[model samples]
Target: MADLTIRNLTITPLELVSVERFQGEKKRTGNVVSNVTGAITGFINATDFSAHHILPKGDSHDSRDVSFHLDPFRTVRTDVRSADPAGREVLRLTFRAGDRRYETDVPSPSRKSSVMKRIDGDDDVDDALDLTVVYVPTGAFLAIFSSAKLYAWMKQLDDAWPLPLLSIPGTHNSPTCHTALPSVRCQSVGVPEQLQNGVRFLDIRVSVNTDNDTLALVHSVFPVSLTSIKYFSDMVDDIYRFLDANPSETVLMSIKREGAGRGTDQHLSRYLKAGFVDKNADRWWTEPRIPTLGQARGRIIIVRRFGLDEEMARSCWDGRGWGIDGQHWPDNCEDGTCEGGHIRVQDFYDVTESQNIEKKIDYSRGQLERSAEREFHVIGPEHDHNPDPALLPIFVNFLSGSNFFNATCWPERIAAKVNPAIVEYLCIRHGEDGKGPNQLKVGAASTGIVVTDWVGANGDWDLIRCIVGWNARLQLP
Candidate 1:
């Protein structure tokens, strides 16, 4: 239980070592103990093994280089912190196993606990492995399940930074987490859990019932949950709780009109105004333009997927009170721009069969590549002084697809194939593993906001971690 385990995801034999440390109580002449890549028996070999590491009793800071014996020996210098920013005792790690090098923050488990046991068993399961997957020339992954990094990942961002330049992790259908048909439910985790796991954007669909003037959370014509119907007001309450607890974070809302609503998008808009905007103006930002992180912290940045009603236009607090104008976005558009070039979207969700998921992945990757090459506009402490400049378009890429007739093309099924491939693509293309031009240029390239589905499924948050890690590029020189 004192040792940290390595779950090697590759077939190669890898060795992890520390190159710097003070003389310790333990004695060692050689690495007689082969934790990972050691032969189990004459006929069998063990893929996952444990390294003899005991957590420091105190929150002391140590610097060490994690070396891998894989081909072309690579050493990663990292600070070994005994605790994270929240003052929670943690075990910071850096090592390599498969075709990737990982830097992780693992919460120090109880003396009677094992890191691998918590990951594979009925323990605290909401903890995210704040893992950065960097592809090396050889070898893939060494897994770790750690702290709730998604709770406050944006605290590191500059207050002046634009939302478009930040690599925000979002869900395709943020609140569709319930017992329903495969096509109706897009997520397994609920709204609050999604935000805890580092998802910042929520894609919501609401239908208005004229009978009682209530809004129902829905996906197409069906309710989000067949057993229990969810209302739009309750979902907003969930956002309130998360943002109140993590004041450093903000939530972007993409609200569209769907389901069997007896009213039009205008009715839906009025219902939102009466329910959230007028009563709790402090928690909502209904501007038609993008705002900096400083302007939106602890607030919901609304991206109006529904049209702005003419009557409500005059009700603006600032004479333009509607949210980010996203009315009439062309369906199934690839690399399309709208609202006078403020937002660019790729929402091609038409993967008819399971085999055609590759096509959707290609389109999604293309959008990421486009966002990477953006002429970015950021406001930080530097030579730049103009607080607000002409806005640059933000890329909102949707890697979500489904076939109405084909059960094989449901959200979860498609995500199983697409998310891993996208994660691999990001690692390979932006590895930071000494591969020239295969990395995101620090403080330059941005992935914008990536809307996905089924995140944190079966203990996998590599995609979220990669997206959040890229924000480090903005922080670094």
Candidate 2:
């Protein structure tokens, strides 16, 4: 076991099978990795690329059965340093099964160097076990991820699970975060990074420049960046790209009309329809009712905070009502409900001072408890594990709060306190990072959609990881 192995990735019991390597008509099928589990389990012979006798074209076989990338495609490995004719010691792995073929480097050249850390001469002490159901796009093998293993939590979930019941991580002012003003900027990462890290909900506020019908992202009255203005389409494009790549995942985008522009809520609605929604209609689900995972995959579930323009309401959404209407949602609501009562929130943002941060933390924990308590018991054998949608409410708990003068109560400052606190609370409440302990008492609890700010603060996405970890409750047999 000197190189890549499946045991290094997961504890799941895998059936042993032959791993074949091939190119064109030239095919070789044998136990490449000497171990028991179907994937590249046990130990893979990490050797120089030239020894493998690859084709002159460098193109390999397409393993029709369970296709994945081959190791040592065209780059040198940081770990393996050897001298070939090209002076590169690349570990090349070519796997072929049935009529299919796939091959790439073990530490994929396409992936960043951070993923390379996992392969240090067969030390499997890593986060592969933490993954709910992680898979690498570069390898598509198992739960072993390169960067952050949370790229796809929803993929493990049952497609029939309704949107309201799933435990989803989200960001407040997602796109606005670029590290500028503390009062306005609410996040550190852009929309794409947030989605890639398993954030499924996005809190968005847009300013409509009615003068030119252009949209700019805003947090309260201040622009996200002090030097430049970030536009609304920029955020939309980020979401578009993320969904395009990870179609198995979905985003519940909460769009509201607010900012330092002359744009009205009416103008905001029309612009979204004419500019983005209408053009790429397939990318969005505009209906008000909650959707099952099957229906929302590869699409954006619009949580419209503004009502549609009067005329479009009758013509659009197939008269199905426009988005999950949260238009009447009042400000700073504590365990508040929208007009239709489809949404429940705990957005107590009035933290005038730093000491009140504890109060804010308490409010957030209360909401998570409420959301978990209601849905946990019903999903047992009594409900056939398919609880009624009516019994489930969409819980939106905000760990975001701020103050103008209080330096400690600023957005980033507040997240420092709130984010870590919630992570600690959930771990204890849920117990030992697995479903068995909590599931026994509460039948697999859920925290619903949790919104926060300043994620990835010092490479710590624990809060997001914890929020996503709760989805294990829904993944039970």
Candidate 3:
């Protein structure tokens, strides 16, 4: 398996463009008597088309601007143009692999087309053609798959598994992709990409701009990036699109207040209630209880990290009474039970004084061990007779840490070093010998909601793979 590799995968789409043209003539606006001498004539206006025009004969046209790069595993590009000025003919695709190339005018199964009408005053029209490449493995690589295909494994699990019992992959500072600041930027991908790659948990920090009267996503005071920050409404729409497409999957979003505005928390709370929670209450799990896999499907579980005033609390729309409270959340507490077993946390982000990298890694392992111990108590004789998934506590682990002064302790740096170590430990059996400490036993109860930064960076997915692999024990003989 170490020597397994993908040789080549490429896709190219051809000839699918929409065009629209508009023409108008000038006319006299004054009275008929004043236009008796001579009337001014109107000329044809500019024409609009959905795609770019091909240059005349002997003139080279560059179509590279219309191309798109697909996923990291493969490269794909699409180009389209009319062969004649009359828009009568279209040039097709020529696929190239190795030293051979083949030209074909027939459309493949991957080709698709759609037309979009302009809603504004402009009469322009847009015709879009797309080609989707589905990579089907051949030879020995057929048995291999990436962690992004996690939905296939999740569908096989029992619907009775509580959301807290399963291990989940999460991203920290999930929407800071446009920011180049290493200290503040944590994620390399946007929310949609993260969701597509099996990230079920999101650490979203929001702030209210009182001047603009809009809710925006922010990471502390750093503005996230110089580029335009996404509005909270846009973020919600993106989540809805993903959930609507994949009904079997569920997302746990943790929202908190950032920035120094006076009534920012209250303002955000109101906007969320009026705009989202009130209108789409059915799509969300806003109750103050843990849910099972079957109950949470096609819904977004809210984890509010802000304080609610008395007025806001009285209203059912207040999200503070939702899934979990970040205020009551314990810091670095490894017992896996906080607020009398209502909430559990594994947040250990401070690594400034750590002598070596192994110290942070050991702390994470110890936390998971404690989480396993708590799960065992539920399965033990004390509560075995009356097992309830709702009463079971939730475990939230943070695999992200940083030290601003030392570049070696940045989020990416720590993740690069610690993620592999965690995967290696999870792969070993309880009695086997491995590097460092062996506190955690490899099984179904070993992990829960492991969150981190830069998840698909450098094509390293060992940590997420191990977390998903641990579920195999639940189906054993």
User: How many clashes in each structure?
Assistant: 4, 14, 1
* TM-score of candidate 2 relative to the true fold: 0.67
List the global CA lDDT of all models.
0.65, 0.63, 0.54
lDDT of 3 at 374: 39
Candidate 2 segments exceeding 4 Å error: 1-148, 376-391, 431-443
User: What range of 10 consecutive residues in model 2 has the weakest lDDT sum?
Assistant: 42-51
Q: Give one digit per residue, the lDDT tens place, for model 1 in 61-135.
A: 455665545322122223332233232344445444343333333432221112322122334435323333232
- Cα deviation of 223, candidate 3, in Å: 2.0
Residue pairs with colliding backbones in model 3 are 26-42
Candidate 1: lDDT of 156?
A: 66
lDDT for model 1? 0.65
Per-residue lDDT, model 3, residue 420, is: 57
Candidate 2 lDDT over 1-477, as tens digits, reads 132232112222222122323222222233455223323211121111111222222443332233233231111112222112221223333333222222334332222112222222335453232222121222122222122357777877677677777778989988866656667777777888888888999998888867666888788787878888888887788888888888888889999888778878888888888888889999998877788888999899889899778887887768757888888886897689887877899999989998899989888877787677654333554344455563356999999998978777788778877876776566444422223323333434678899998886434576787677666555444
Root-mean-square deviation (CA) per prediction: 11.8, 14.6, 17.7
User: Would you estimate the TM-scores of all the predictions?
Assistant: 0.71, 0.67, 0.63
Query: How many clashes show up in model 2?
Result: 14
